[model samples]
Target chain A: MRINPKTLEEVAFKLLEKAATSLPDDVKKALKSAYEREDSPTAKTELKNILDNIESAEKLKKPLCQDTGMISFYVRSREIENFVEVRKALIDATVKATETIPLRPNAVHPITRKNTGNNVGEHIPHIEWIYTDQDHVELIASIKGGGSENMSALAMITPGLGVKGVKKFIVDTVVKAGAQPCPPTIVGVGLGGTVEISFKLAKLALLRPLGSRNKDKDISRLEDELFNLINQTGVGPMGLGGKTTCLDVKIEYAHCHTATLPVAVYFQCWADRRASAKISLDGSFEFIV
Target chain B: MVEYRLKTPLKEDEVRKLNVGDILYITGTIFSARDQAHRRILEYAEKGLELPFNLDGAVIFHVGPIMQRKDDRWVVVSAGPTTSTRMNSTTPKLLERFRVRVIIGKGGMSFEVAEALKRFGAVYCHFTGGAGVLAAKNIKEVEGVEWIDLGMPEAVWKLKVEDFGPVTVTIDSKGRSLYETVKKSVEENLKKIYQQI
Candidate 1:
């Protein structure tokens, strides 16, 4: 089955708009509960401000944060004939969204630091593909701001150190990142892969909805353990000090070489902006979040 | 923990009175300068060149707002704090060169910046990170802009704002820092967690 490139472009543009302007429901619910349970007046104020900011952005149809963020599209399809066309359409959508949604032109040259004006540049609007037997095309758009992105970490640990080392690294990263990534953050942990794969998995793990556990019971238990350990730090909202530091911790893992253990951690700030859509071969699409 | 409504071109006396954790709602003019702009400011000062805008007693917001041109004027769609820690190296010098009374951003700054705040009679404030729309709503006007060649985000935007906060003082002129206090406790907590896990 084939879908029109124009339809894909429009869908991609709307996804960018939706991702930028609205905080996902799962994130909102987590934040609301964080606010309810928080004890520190300062932490509560920060959370309240965030809640108010979300409301204003939705009401006014404005981008949620000034850092509209680097865009990434995760596409999953079983059989699609227009892979090249799909890529082009997504880029075109990004260029259009930069002006209409008025994203902050975040993409820049690494060396010279020249702004691209539109959010597109070399290797930008990074598209990741997954092939599945699904009947419909699944596209997930995630926008992550620089502050949180800067906090991402990759650690190569001794194999003998095991899960305890992984847990230590995760907590250390969060405490080190205190207040910068805009807590209460949602942490994504990627474990037991090659260096790059671990980092990629960590970022990909962020696409999962808050409160969703991994299918693997061991990993799910590990997620719960880290979540509690992080919150116990009292790093709190905006890291000024309070009870809740992390709203949720999501983990994704792959089997590693017998000699190596690589762990990567990624943080999504409180905004946690993302949206998903399922596009049918008939050219119809529905936003899932 | 006090709340004060301040107006810029703020006096040193007023800034010195602020304590860590005090909330401020500021009025009048402020300028937005990120990493690049901060570099340029120091460069210009070193070259003995005059700046396009005044920095004396100014509020420097570490933001790169999403701006749009409607007719002839620039409108701010969203303006939020960028991480201030990135500016730590240059900030002490900026404060030393000018009477920059309030430094507003997120993630706080280093002990060096806190020391500079103490020395220069200024305070570092945090405008809740990622609260862009809220920040823009309080910004009344884009009074002017400079260094457009530096690109939209890096350009020096002279903003007119009113009640432009709920910004909290995280590092005060007295050398007390809310971030430092929190960091100590987090470290202590980290030690405990390490022992358990």
Candidate 2:
């Protein structure tokens, strides 16, 4: 059984590029819904413009924005009896994809603050392994851009803050962010962990479908409440005033310290970039691309 | 909010007409320079070198564009507004040195830049941040690059643009700011709504 690391990378590279130009189906549906419910004239106009932009991007093969974001992927690979060239393949794939897909070289020198000439860097384009052993490698590719990435938040408040305080903090963060995150955003909220874990979990929560309801009854109830409160801020589509400030409010939680209430909020823009693939140990592969 | 359609070599009277929140679709040639290139341009101006683009009444968009491959040519990727606060320190220097009239970017501008825009008869125009694809359509063409070696993202892209839709004058010549208005209003509203019943 053998897997072509070169092919895997090319697929990943092309997937990232496609995701930039093509809005995910879930995200598209959410925006269309947001446009229908948006009350502010200005916000509505912005929403329509965004939809139009999406259409043009698909038709003309132009990126949804000029700043096609930095590409990041999450991989879950399994060890089989064969395959020695996995690591080399991955690196070669990155460089190959960098040329083929031509991802904007986003990785920079940590100190000099200069681009690394390639998107690949020490910790960049991180490939987090999900630890699935099914005789194959499965990768989830996400092209996280800058604007929404800049809006990420984490709080290690006292236990006294509780869920209500958590709600208040999340609202403040998004409201203050205003139009900065690109309105009708998909918010990923992670609760109860160490500060770093909370931040990571919060970002992971963004992978959920746009309007899917949380299975946890208690968390789902909170999700509804926060979603309503956020939209009430009237920071519509582009912060020009609107009812649908966010397309969805996603929450994730883990066990925490006795005195700590760690919280994080990660915002995903309307672009909502993501794609995935599965490569079998038998050289067969499938990708969202 | 004031709306005007004027050509280059813009005068003080033209500058005086724009008010905060006024949406202007400016036409003409503008030089696009982001962080790295801005640093180089300022360094060049210090050494008394002529700028790549004519400075008088010129607009400088603070953007670093992404490149896409299109049949032997590299095109712009999603080039949207970056945080403009990063430019606060460099911008006044650029405005004073280069005589730049209009600045386009996202987020808030610095006090010094705002003050300079007013004093020097310039205006700080803000396009809707994150709407790069929409903004690109208004760009008629990429005239050329000054420093091609700077790579695709950091290069100083000269763009000929027309009616780039829906850019607001967040900072006007008379010294007004839409951010200030919104922030003040939000603050005032925050106090009223959150006050203990």
Candidate 3:
């Protein structure tokens, strides 16, 4: 089935707009739950204010965070006839969304520090395409906020150190990151991969819904254990000292060389901005949460 | 734990009285500066050039607001605090040269910046990060902007604010720092956790 470029652009713009102004249902639920579990008075107030901010942004149709974040598109598609058109549509939609949704002009040239103003520079809205067997195309759009993005870390450990070493690295990153990543953060851990692949997996893990566990029992156990250890550090909401420092911890792993264990830790602030959509050959699109 | 309503062009006494963890609802006027604006201010100080705005007793917010035109005037859509540590390299100079009494941002700054805050009789305040929409509600007006060439995020925004904060004093003039305390306590806990593992 061939999808029209115009239809794809429209769908992309809607996804970008929705991703900017509203928190996903899973993220909203997690924040509410965190607010209830938070023990510190300051943390509770911080959580309440964040919840209020989310509601106001949604109601007013404005961005939930000022940063607006760098746009990322993760696409899972079957054989589509208009693949090239789809790419162009995604780019055009980003420019249109910048003006209509009025996103902050976040794309800047590294050497000269020139802002593109339209949120589209060279590779500004990062797109990753994954082929699948499904007849329809599914796209997951996520915004990686600057505050949390700054805290991403990777460590190459010797295989002898094992899971215990990975745990310490993740915990230390969270500790040092502290209030910088804007706790209670959603932590994504990638283990057993090479340097770059591990980091990619770490970010991919964030696309998973909050509170969902890895299918592997061992990995899921690590997620649960790390979740508690991170929260116990008392970094709390906005790192103001509390019982609920981390809302969730997710782990994604890949096979690595026998000699090296590369672990990447990524954090997403509680804003947790993301949305998904499915597009059919008839040029129709449906938002999935 | 005390809540205080502070007006800008703040007095030394007003700044000195702030303790770590005190909630503040600051009013009056405040200027916004991120890393680039701060660097320019330091450069201006170096060249002995007169600044576009007065800095004495000023409260500088670390932010890059999302502004759009509304009814022929600029309105802030969202204006949350940026991380302050990124500006730590320039903050001590800004504090000393500008005599800024209050610095507001998210996450805490480093020891050097904290010490500068102490020496200058200033305090570092922290607003909730990513609560840009909530913060925008407190901004009553966009007075003017300077260094437009620095781009939106890097420009110096003069804002008129009223009861403009749901902020906490994270680093106080008396050498007390909530971030430092938290880090130290967390380190102690890490020791125990590591042993258990």
- Across A1-289, the per-residue lDDT of candidate 1 in tens digits comes to 5658998899999999999999889999999988999887888898999999999999999998999999999888886788899999999999999999989999999999999999899999999888899889888888899999999899999999998888999999999899989888999989988998898888878998999999999999999999999999999998889998999999999999999999999999988989999998889999998
Model 3 Cα displacement at A48 (Å)? Answer: 1.0
lDDT of 2 by residue, A103-156 (tens): 567677767766776777786666665656567777677777677878778877
lDDT string for model 1 (B102-136, tens) is 99999899999999999999999988889999999
The better candidate by DockQ, 1 or 3, is: 1
Expressed as tens digits, the lDDT of each residue in A265-285 for candidate 3 is 999999899888998877778
> Residues B1-197, candidate 2, lDDT per residue (tens digit)?
55666555556667778888777777888777877888888999889888777878787787777655577655665566666776888888887776677788876676788888888888877665666677777777677778867666678887777876577777888888766665565555445434421
User: What TM-score does each model's chain B reach against the true chain B?
Assistant: 0.98, 0.88, 0.97
- Name model 1 segments beyond 4 Å from true: none
Q: How does each model score on TM-score?
A: 0.99, 0.89, 0.98
Ranking by lDDT: 1, 3, 2
Runs in model 2 lying further than 4 Å from the true structure: A1-7, A77-84, A87-93, A133-137, A279-289, B1-3, B45-49, B68-78, B148-150, B188-197
Interface RMSD of each: 0.7, 2.9, 0.9
Full candidate order by TM-score, most accurate first:
1, 3, 2
Cα shift from native, residue A9, model 2 (Å): 2.6
